[model samples]
Target: MKIPTAAGFVTLMLFCLVHAEICPLSCICKPLGEMKGWLVDCSSKGLKEVPALSVSTRKLYLQNNSMTTVRAGAFDNLRNLEEVNVSDNPWNCDCDILYLKLWLEDFSESSIANVICATPASNERKPLSQLSGNELDSCRKSLPIKCLDFFWRDLALITFAVLVLILTLCALRKHLRKIVLCV
Candidate 1:
């Protein structure tokens, strides 16, 4: 019933801070001894995309899922990750898988040996590391053409609207002058 001392409160806060681990949703996180790092296992959770991981994660397991392509820069924050397993997933080896390939080459080169493509018939069963940039899907190369198409369409619409507005203003000029004189 008595009030707790400041020392006891500080000890309680430190205990909570030491035990907290950033476990992602539907994932199991186990702390290494002495809190050296965490082993985040998110394998076979029916994951469509890679979940956000903590920076303290040293080992990550994300195999045997339905992931086709990971979003760009999804793994940019995991600087402390030592090992990652993303094999056995249906990886679409198109323009989208480039980010994962590049990140693996820089962070964990050995892991790339297990990443095999499952889609894009031409690249199917091919090792992601072995696929050259030129072999990617044609959509990436057509990006500039699509962008130019959008730009011209938008420009033509804007020009037509501006001309209509000018014509309407000119048509109302006589009425506007009369109204202004009365005011």
Candidate 2:
């Protein structure tokens, strides 16, 4: 009976060790009971960037870090995420931050309420949830320079087409009048 108990303990220990190894190096991960998911805690790590998270993360804590922005699709793999805290960080609310804001809005609206801007002076301390697309620094420049080039090229083609149509009408006016007189 003792030998069987010891073997069970060893098996459990090995399982736990392997499970813990799935967590990111910069964060702490704990199972959320019965294989539901993990509770990943990366708060107050002074992290400049979001650490890679386990796919099974359900509750993520990233508050009080130095992170300025979360890359686009950073949390896409966490299909089981139920809650996330990204407050108290120096989030630079620029065009790059749009992804985080939009993601939070779709994932959990309440989470974005506490996310505040920490850069670009005008947006400092402003709630990320309150920011409009126009408020972001480079968002207003959404139309690229290449788009302008296309606009100019299209305008020139339209103008040339109109000029050719006018010339054709002028050249045919004498024939039109002759036809009218004969009729």
Candidate 3:
């Protein structure tokens, strides 16, 4: 076999460096034409926030990290994001986190169900789906009046049915008494 030429080796090294720069942090960024997903695995990296990713990234994994605070616009550029896992991170529960929590809740394909808070707060380790919007706003600590409205609607329906049944029973009793008296 012939030895590789000096010029060929230098060109190969330059190509490698250029390709490495485009790779995402802790991820294998593969460009599949103009429309395809980039895979990211950022677990256990002690990342405080998500790193810059290509617009092609659809699935992201930031689990088991030291991330304490995620800024509002951290994921704004990733419009194609379909799945994300930020589980096992030490999430700081505050009003600032409200936007991300609410956005995750509303995202059609995102699954933050396992993402939990690690803190001195009451909702620690709680699944996000199990918590109501008011409970999620526990930092605010005031329940929304919508809960009361739901309660009243159910109560009113039951009360109306009971009154209708009572009136029907009274009419039946009166009619039975008249028949007995006639007999």
Candidate 4:
């Protein structure tokens, strides 16, 4: 019985060793009870960027990091994510962070209430979850007017109307000249 217990302990140690490689070098990851994934704790690490997380990550703690921006679709592959803590980071509330803001909106309000904007004085300390769609729209870069916005058919119709008006005005002027000549 003692031998079997020792073997079980060795096996558990080996499992933890193998799993250690799955976590980021800068972060500590531990499994939750009976859960299928890890809880990544990367808070207060002064990390400049988000650590590479596995598909098995359930919760991410990144508070008090130096990350000012998060790349778009950064968490797209993490399907099991239940909570993300990104508070106390110097968040730049700009177009770069628009994706994160939109993604936070998908989670429960309580889960996202902790995410606050740290920059753009107008939005400083505001909860990301509470921002309205129109308010969030401020983070998106405005689309420039492109030729595609106007249909060719509409332009053609306007051109045709202008040509007809010019022709009618010219004919009327000619008729008026004739009438003046007759007088």
Which digits, one per residue and each the tens of the lDDT, describe model 2 over residues 74-144? 98888889999999999998999999999999987799999999998999989999999989999989845
lDDT of 3 at 13: 96
lDDT of 3: 0.73
Question: Candidate 3, residue 111: CA error in Å?
Answer: 1.0
Best prediction by lDDT: 2
Error of 4 at 174 (Å): 35
**Per-residue accuracy of model 1 over 1-183 as CA lDDT, tens digit each:** 988799999998886665454777788889876667899899999999998778888999999999999999888888878889999999999988889998888876789889999989999999998987778786458555677899999999999999999999997997899999999
lDDT of 4 by residue, 1-183 (tens): 355688889999898776775588889888886757889999999998887788989989999999887898888888998888888888777667777777877765665677788777867888766665445545444654457656776789999999999999999999999999999
Q: How close is candidate 3 to the true structure, as a TM-score?
A: 0.58
RMSD of each: 7.7, 6.6, 12.2, 10.3
* Candidates ranked, most accurate by lDDT first: 2, 1, 4, 3
What TM-score would each prediction reach against the true structure?
A: 0.66, 0.71, 0.58, 0.65
Q: Residue 168 of model 4: what lDDT?
A: 100
Alpha carbon lDDT at 26, candidate 2: 74
Select the stronger candidate by lDDT from 3 and 4: 4
Cα deviation of 63 in candidate 3 (Å)? 1.2
